[model samples]
Target: MSNLNKLDFTTLEVSGRNYLKWVQDVKLYFTAKSLKATIEELIDNEPANEAKKATAMIFIQRHIYDAPQTEYLPEEDPRTFWLALADHFNHQKDIHLLEARHDWQRLCFQDFKSLNEYNSEVCRI
Candidate 1:
């Protein structure tokens, strides 16, 4: 209470803004992925016949199969970051197949057992 007058909020605000910029820089978020060069390739070569299955496979591979393979593992806070991304991808795929696209062919693409089975596997607290 007595020390409140001594605080310099300007420094704190600058540091917080810088920290947020740094976070945006390194975060592999959707915005960054949207700007990636591979998006066009992925969209163009998207398997129309088995898009849902292929999407599920890609999600599984990227999240569960590829995440821990790297030397620099995910930190504790988002150790299962890959899984979360995969969940997002899976949700998007399901929505595209079942709702937005409204493809009757996609009606049979609900054979995604892995995504359904291991949606959120609790590892670290």
Candidate 2:
């Protein structure tokens, strides 16, 4: 509980622009807390303890932006909540990938006023 105050990463945003990085951060944090099993799809043998699931729920609630937090407030199982979030964010990630691809396809050196500007856009894409 004391470590909850030390949020080492940005909260998951409703816009999901940072979803990929947020997923990575969440996985690392869960692993560190031995709560990874609460979010995993398969169990080796035994189910995750209720206390661990509750702790995971609290951690997820704390690390997400307010809109999603409210939307998922009724959720009781951490694994189910985690899957729902993953489904939404995976779609978001695909949309961003398509947009980036479109931008890359349309990119042209002559479209920019300066070489640096074109380079910057390329880097961004």
Candidate 3:
């Protein structure tokens, strides 16, 4: 196993609703550092569902920030927390796609005063 002292979990902080990507990145980081066994140990030590949930929350506490002064609650199962974030962000992504489509549909060459400006606007869209 690699030296755990040199690893910084803080660098894996989960910001916004990018939980899926964040989780993948964290897992890869852990694997790269040969700390995958450490994660298994954490899960193994918590036998009961409640214990596992609490353990998960605590394990990820410093690595996640849902809001200002608000972190994942003890009642939240880490799996549930990640799933909820994934679902929420997926919905937001759909909304963003729709907005982009609307904006693209409304874009017009006449809105720009010059050929170069119109080309830039089209490229932006």
Q: Say which candidate scores most in lDDT.
A: 2
Candidate 1: tens digits of C-alpha lDDT, residues 63-103: 33233334224322231433444333334444444543553
Candidate 3, residue 25: Cα displacement in angstroms equals 6.5
Give the alpha carbon lDDT tens digit for every residue of 8-64 in model 3.
444333444454456677567556754444344356474335554565555555456
- lDDT scores for all predictions? 0.33, 0.89, 0.55
Total clashes for model 3: 0
Model 3 TM-score (2 dp): 0.44
lDDT of 2 at 124: 96
> Sort by TM-score, best first: what order?
2, 3, 1
Spell out the clash pairs found in candidate 3.
none
Q: What is the Å distance of residue 56 in model 1 from its true position?
A: 20
After aligning candidate 1 to the native by TM-score, how far in Å is the CA of 41 from where it should be?
Answer: 26
lDDT score for candidate 3 against the true structure: 0.55
Clashes of 2: 0
Selected candidate, larger lDDT, 1 vs 2: 2
